[model samples]
Target: MKGRTFKHAMAAHCESGTLTALLNHAGLKISEPMVFGISGGIFFGYFESKKFPFPTFVVRSRPGQIRTALARRIGVKFAERRFRNPADGEKELDRLLSLQIPAACQTDFFYMNYLPGHVRVHINVHFVVVVEKRGEAYIISDCYSPELASLNRDSLMKARFAGGSFAPKGFLFYPVSVPEAIDFRKAVWKGIRSASFYMVKLPMPFLGVKGIRMFAQKVVDWPRLARDTEHLSHEIMKINIFLEDQGTGGAGFRFMYATFLREASELLNDRDLLEMSKRIMEIGDRWREISLFAARIGKRRDLGPDRLRELSGLIHERADAEEIFFKELLAMSKKKK
Candidate 1:
């Protein structure tokens, strides 16, 4: 959501069916299925993925669900933006996923509906091949090259038709055989990486893709951010106290902001500091972004100037946070030089 990286966007493409067309349209001889997991969302090979909301389809696991895809389709939830938590930094990771599934219909999907258990381990990855009914057997690896960008239509149709995810590569747990689940994670992920900005922008902000945005908005969206920041400032102060609460051999690195700032100052460069500064401002941008949203809503009477000032204070506090990052970064950059 915050940054636009190809890895982050791969799920959207696979979920959306765009990748199928891209690969299949290329006239490759399609073969097998890829295992993209289900129920619990799955993240493929990349890290640093931000959360994405997709319309989820909840299906009833009835025995004959797959016979008719339309009979198997369930409810879809429209995802709203969710915030990012700072505590999530540098920790054990959770995967991010987005989807573009047919609301109802099927040869490949409507199968999840008939499950008795809530967490069905439908395929873990996806199996994809682009076989031209009788063509040169050009596989999807048989399709787009980095230099070629985009797929031709005839091949796309074939890939799309055969497209469906498989279980992880080299895993023996497949309930069904995909025959070949190779080379497609990258290809499918590549397809996801190509969607339009507007398509992912809303998801980005909500997903808290930009930690800086959350960091910034933590103080700015004071509609809630204000109260929460107030609580966080108190809690972080508490946690800071808690960090030092335990017994210490006093052998490990002492972690004071001052120490971090001091060491950081000696470690980075002007360019790095400038890049850091640029990034800090992006957080600051969230304030204006929200303000613009409010202004467009145009409820002058609904949002008083006092409320606006309070919001301004919230943003200013975020600026203060940015200022802290900047000052520490600048100090380090100077030291590094």
Candidate 2:
């Protein structure tokens, strides 16, 4: 394997970062937030998964959706394939590399040696780019890693084939063709409209702003649902870590979305969206406060149901603010149209 002149940059989220690098390599020169927002990647979902010991909270759409949306919106032709055999997947990736194309693949972080031991988990939706192969090792650019790292072929295969939810199955994707020009305005409008629709029009109670409210209600009842103080503390810690420590760009992806909104505002010359962007940043701050409070509760282990209820009330306020904000955004977009 020879050196390829691909520019590798760090980013906040994996999928968005991978897309940003891929598009830049293809001469698009877009930022991560632009890729994220224009792909309608921001949203919320909360549910109890039997596969896990606790509930699940997600701040963005499921994996692969952002890549698909970004490709379609910007008129980039791409191909994604999942393999049943790991050897075949390796051959396919090598083929792409031979043609000077960087390939992005989904893998489990637990097998990535660059991550801290504590942070390594069996998360299979993590995405990374393979830029070059040096004999037995593959040079990878993982967004979450502090710097680029190399993994031996055996290690890369293990990460790609890790068994669990959202299993990678050696999935690989790359843009086949890119347009010379993109309809930025149309893409931005379509992206914003889709996000607004999901936030304001989604009927599921465990999605959008409604999901926040529902989760807050559940938080209020944690004492009654848990068997003891230890159980309640564990649950609080889990929620706090998921919101504050996960690769959400801080505050459960609210900060990232705020940045995207600010960028979109300038691109579209819409001051209203700019104001909303500031408001969303404030919301992200509020979310950080909630996480801090949860951490405190987890450590002290003395917060009663009434105290928990107060925290739940704060979350309710956040939900109310988000609900109003999304509705206003949708109305503003419609008026502009």
Candidate 3:
């Protein structure tokens, strides 16, 4: 595989970052937040499964959907290929690299050597760009990493083919073509409308603003419902850390969405979105405070149900704010149309 001038820039999230790099390389010059928002990636989901030790909470859409959604909305053509055979997958990646094309691959963060030991869990939806293959390693641009890193061929294979739910299965994607021009205003309107619909109108209670409220109620009941209070506290602490400390660009991606709204406001010359952006930023700060409160309660020796209730109240407040904001956003979008 040959090398090309692929620039690596740090971003808040992996899928958006990889798509940003690919689009820029294809001459589209898009930003991470643009890719994220235009694809309607901001979302919430909470589900309980026997496979997971505790309830699962996610701040964004399921893996691989963002790329597909962005491509469909922006008139770009992308190709994704998955392999049951690792050797065949490597060969295809080599073929693309030989053409000097960078490909995004889904992988397990546990196998990425650049990440810290503590964070190397069995997360399989992590995205990285495999730009070129060196003699024994694959050059990658991982968004969370400070600098470019190289993964050994063996490790890369393991990461790509890691077993579990949402496994990559040696999948790779790259943009085949991008439109020379885009209707930024139209795209922004569509993006905002779709996001608002998902947040406010989704039927499932375990998604969007309703999911936030549901999770809060669960948190409030943890002390009484949990069979093991210590284990439950630890799980709650993990949720807090995941929400605030993970590379979610703060407030589990509310700040990222707020930035997109700010940009959209300037692009569309709408002051309403600007005001909503400020309000969302304030909400993000509140979320950060809640995380801090939850963390403090997690560390306490006694199970503090009252503090948990306080945290629940804060989440309920956030949910209320989000519901109003999205409803207004939907109205604004309808007016623009």
Assess candidate 1 and give its lDDT: 0.25
lDDT for each residue of candidate 1 in 212-303, tens digit (9 for 90 to 100): 23433343333342244344234223211212221110101012222222322233322443354354445435434444433432333233
- lDDT against true structure, model 3: 0.85
Runs in model 1 lying further than 4 Å from the true structure: 1-8, 11-301
How well is each residue in 57-174 modelled by candidate 3, as lDDT tens digits?
8888878888988888889998899999999999999999888989999999899987888777788999999988889899999988888998999999999999899979899999
Candidate 2, poorest ten consecutive residues by summed lDDT: 1-10
- lDDT per prediction? 0.25, 0.85, 0.85
Candidate 2's C-alpha runs over 4 A off are: 1-4, 223-231
- Residue 42, model 3: lDDT of 84
Best candidate, TM-score: 3
TM-score for each model: 0.19, 0.94, 0.95
Clash pairs, candidate 3, are none
The alpha-carbon lDDT assigned to residue 269 of candidate 3 equals 90
